[model samples]
Target: MATTLDAPGRGTRRARAPHPAPAVQAPTKKYRLAAAGFLSPALVLIAAFVVLPMVLTLWISLHRWSMFTPITDMEFVGLDNYRAVVASSTHMAAVRNTVVYVGLSAAVTIPLALLLALLLYFPQLRGRGVVRVLLFATYVVPTVAIVIIWSNVYAPGYGPLDNLLALVGVDSPGWLSNPDAALYSLVIFNVWQMLGYYVVLLVAGLTQIPEEVYEAARIDGAGPVRQTVSITVPLLRGALVFVLLMAVINSIQVFDPVYLLTQGGPVDATNVLSFDIQRTAFQNGLAGEASAMAFSLLVLLAAVAGILGAVRRRA
Candidate 1:
């Protein structure tokens, strides 16, 4: 019924209009306000507890102040407090003791911890779980209580240690009273207290390693020694790095044992920076000098952490 002319436009398809892409909707004003509301508490707490204290310490360090005097009476002393600290033999002894304590603690703690972790990591090991709990309990116990227990164990005569040594006809050395032994006694206590923590950390790292890796090593004729040296230690590097840094930090900040056991006594042998800081602030009433010492220790820790970070990155 239609000629080609009559069937108008039937053979030609019309081009459809292109649809536009959807617009990206920006967040509403209420969303940002709600986010701010959620973050405000944490922000305020950090400012009040962390940032404000740091700022106050820095401000105080620049002045000659005393706890006995009004804050308004603080005199601007610039770097004199720092200079005095540098020149003082007491501070120098503190620094030396801190270095030795940190060094020895890290040296003994890490390997001992690794060994303990390896001992407990086996599936067939009986009572491993109980042992882990007991060890960690010792760590979580109050530091003061730990010092008290160790003091009894190290008492000059008829102490548990002395009694044991007496069986072998050996005279007990003064653990806390002797200048040479006080710091080392504290070190031993630190190592014992910290060992379980590092073991836990290493155990966590050990779990991350796939069993397939060990199986492959076994297939390649690897003995337990080879497996540990080649496989376990290499893979546990990350955990070890963290443990080392933390151990050093803890060692440097040691005050509890020194305070409770030795009180930096026997010619100031057990004196470390933290105890010195307390002595300066409370005993000497040198608030400004204490602030300076605290800030200096902060700087040293920052530098040490930075160096460790760089080493970790390189490794």
Candidate 2:
């Protein structure tokens, strides 16, 4: 009997020794729940504001609807609004003006911004901080205030610019009133307004570049022009792409300055896509048509952005 008990005790100890403790797993469910909780507010806001409105606009664009009419009066018009907007002479004019404005603004703004950035980035420049602040001050000023100031400065009868031109024995054309010059004037204004912001961005990008690269270039007897074209420009590719994309988008949607300065006047010379949409929706009460026009603008911008992004990735 004692021998039998000893055998049973030994068997029990062997069984316990061979069995190890089970491994513990992290609480993935709890972690996921916490992440979801953190993201709830932003997700809710985006759904409510962006997603909902976009869906509503798409739906509205399919119907003949007006702000003044009752909801019950809404009638499904299919693609009639889209056809009308595309065929309208006024709409065509707006499209042409918008293309010109964007092209002009990009041509003038990008080069000026790059030049200013280069000047400011030079180590020999004194009082760089003050210069940066002065340039950036335009960005901080209210848009309406800038419009008012520029309007006064460009006024034909009593403006400083015209007076100076008169002193130089040159006739001053009506900058904002003339059909030929109004769009160009808007382009110049946009370039001046946007130059500071782009300069700051370029400067930041320039600063992030390793100083050793420049030193190496210098030791190799590379002149400033060669250094800029070869090393600086290549490294600044990312920043240049970003600035160019923003410039394109801004130029396409230009409204405030044109509206404030020209009111899309002088035979629709300064009318742009944004102004066209506003006039169609509000002034003409053509909600469906306006939505169609806006959608077209959105598609154009998206296509441009996609092309730019592809180029940037390749670079």
Candidate 3:
């Protein structure tokens, strides 16, 4: 009877009985906002400089843009520029030259670097520190300075190298002027410039091999050559692959030597992809064609990188 009185008020009291406060939710929105704030600057810069430029280059590659034309005047030629560049004999020759340069550089640089590294890192070698310093010093020298110095050395009429060759009853070929020798001269210059860095890199790799392993091999009557081929080379496979890939990529992009030294040649014999791209864009006033060439080069580089990555994974 007492409970039946004032039903609305009783029900209200029962409903208002204390329940647990809502569980404190993680402030996910605030955290997201904070992360966005932290990342904003880098994301903005990347988009503005890299992403936007790449997009613009792709767009321009589809048009007939040139130095002579206004933005509005650019004809929407769609892949015509790409076709022209790919079909051009000059461009094809440049591509061939680039491949040759990369192949030759890799052929020369890898073994030479490995040999230098072995000579420097061998415990039997004397004056290892001095040799290392001398070799690595070339890496720090300015590119322009190196070019000038090599230019003097390779000078046809009056250079010391040519003079020495003349005294030895050998007529020196025009190293920079002759089309056949010009590319070889660039290769020599590149090898000399890159030799020290590779030596240092390989030496670093060699140092990581444990002394106990070599000692064990020695105890098994393994001589120096056997130890190198079986132990050292196997251990150094990673470093060798890294060096080979870098050399290939760098050789493909060779421009400075060809530009400052040969200007792509006595007859376009040394014109590589990079120099050709520059010449097409600036000298020939073919921006669209240049962009197409650049994109094609990018694709080629990407494919090479992918192959190297896959090989590394398999290893």
lDDT of each: 0.90, 0.87, 0.89
| Runs of candidate 1 exceeding 4 Å displacement | 1-33, 313-315
Clashing pairs in 3: none
TM-score of each: 0.89, 0.89, 0.86
For candidate 1, lDDT tens digit of each residue in 22-119? 99999899999999999999999999998899889888999999988889999999999999999999998999999999999999999999999998
Candidate 2, 106-131: lDDT as tens digits: 88888788888889997677799899
Better model by lDDT: candidate 1 vs candidate 3: 1
How does model 1 score by TM-score? Answer: 0.89
By the TM-score metric, which is better: model 1 or model 3? 1
Return the lDDT, model 2, position 86: 80
For model 1 the local lDDT of residue 239 reads 82
What would the per-residue lDDT of candidate 3 be over residues 1-315, giving only the tens digit for each residue? 112334664552223446779999877998989999999999999999988988888888999988666778788999999999979999999999898889988899999999989988886877899999998888789888999999999999799989999998998889989888888888899999988988998999999999999999999999999999999999988888888778888888888888999898889989899999999999998999999998888889889988887775665
